[model samples]
Target: MNRDGAAPTMKGGQFNTDPIAAPNEAATAALSQAEFELFAELGRPRAVEAGQVLFRRGELGTTMFIVASGAIDLDFGDDLVTKRLGPREFFGELGLLIGDHARSADAIVAGAGLLIELRHEEFQRLVDRNPGLVCHFLRRAIMRVVLNEQGLIRRLRRRNQDLEAALDSLYATTHQLNQTEELIRTDELTGLYNRRGLTLRLQESRAIGMPASLGLVLVDCDRFKQVNDDHGHLAGDRVLQAVASILRSVAGPEDVACRLGGDEFCLLVASSNAGDVMRFAEFIVATAQNLMLMPQSPPAMCPVSVGACMVDPRADWNDWYARADEALYQAKRKGGNRVHWQDAALEPV
Candidate 1:
């Protein structure tokens, strides 16, 4: 289309001699007055109406069109910008230059006017008659094709960059969400699974079907409140940390160690026998006893009482907890530093 958006003018079946002013006139390969006259004499003149389709994309074409009057629009699909040709502007030249060339854009009439159609034979005749003019047109056409291709490449690169940026942002958000969830499930002070974390882990384990054998051991630091009262809470914290370290040292890879609350801890171990659970509980008591006997021991370093039970897969968490807690109460009543074991039926073992 011309810069003014006006269709080419015609008078008495002929185009005016004025120079064609196209959009981006410097880049457009418009035919000069002499060239248009030459093509008009050599080519066939066909009258076209508005809304008429000259050729569609992918159609085999052997003819080129010179717009003698009005305008023709070339529609290149796939988000590419369209181009319009006014008088003296030509399209479909590749069809004559390259035999059986597929049309790249759909050529549709924008306004009714005369079009000069040049078939392969007529184009060859014109080429032989004036090789210089044909070469000049070919050079301009090549440059226009290069410029259009470069523009398309630029647009594609920008789209790729935008897509990559969106993916990066999504990944960052997902990573931050995972970190936040981990923090929520962890004990801030003890570096162990908090109560909520333990519950989640148990739920996950249950989802996969409970193992045939499991052991639950509950440990409580005897006189922990007295330690916090006599010595500062800081020392009590250190004692708790030391106990936690012992639990970590003895826990198997498959076992879960957790701090239920202040001075109260739990261990979930994989074991089928009541003896195995009892041994684990006894080990914790012995380890705490050794910590208290260490030279220059921290103040109020008391022993721990332990209660353990072989778990029944059919039983709920409350039943398991109640049995273990009862055993714990019995151990506390007997004396602070000791181990107690209960069978799956809640009978003392």
Candidate 2:
């Protein structure tokens, strides 16, 4: 753990300094200047800038380094800064001493700094000539190995559990967000897309390239007020729900079926063929007439009037809606149960 050369003093009965080991001298005199220079025999000077890659994870390494100044960081290619080595600290000790060792992580320069790289061959020469130094380093390396195997695994396991919990929380939050969005865009009464949803779709449509043809249908329930007046408001709600179901059944997946508030509903569809819009509108009119209402009110109760428009290529949502609304009134004027088609151009009629 003291790879940073941060030991306050060196001690142990096996190793002792002679005259300099005087009673007055402190026991913690770590690597005296002269003694430290011994590593020069193995040193090859290196300098690095911040963020520079010194070595990569899982690479085979035959060298170790001593940080003379600045700092080096070990990473597993994540934002987590795994280990940091300060001045005089050493890393790659395992790979250098253990023949054919592969790096467990990446090394990067954390700041501008210098280092002394010692290859395995130089270490062998040093150990051969200076047999006494072997015991001390070997003891340290063995102790480090024991600590890593035992401590590192326990630490990493706890970290993994913490990560799993964090991921679960993230998933839950995302699902809640989706549910909230669904509620915001849907009409509470009929479960159809609301006016807010339609506005958003319109804005998105405007941003795209012009379609071959877009169709809009405006539907109105005939004498809806009479139902509320003759029967209770509950009966009126049931009538609206029935209308919504009929529109839902008639619409395709790509079509937008919306309750535009009150007794009015709208459908927007896209088709490659210009004639498809008129045909779709006709089908909707026929289907609306046949819709069965509950508790059986008079035939006048749920009749519908439909106005449809094949939107012009150059027109926007406002223009299309106006034309469709005009057609809807024309249908109501002629008779309650009918479909009126808006032309490419809205004449003064």
**Model 2, span 209-292: residue lDDT tens:** 656677888999888898888887888998888788877987887788999999999988876554676777777677766664
Runs of candidate 1 exceeding 4 Å displacement = 1-130, 296-302, 344-349
**Tens digit of per-residue lDDT, candidate 1, span 161-224:** 9889989999999999998888888887778888999889889889998789889999999999
Query: Once all C-alphas are superposed, what RMSD does model 1 give against the true structure?
Result: 5.7
Task: Tell me each candidate's TM-score.
Answer: 0.71, 0.65
List all candidate RMSDs to the true structure: 5.7, 7.3
Considering summed lDDT, which 10 consecutive residues are worst modelled in model 2? 19-28
Model 2 alpha-carbon miss at residue 69, Å: 13
* Candidate 2 CA-lDDT value: 0.72
| Candidate closest to the true structure, highest lDDT | 1
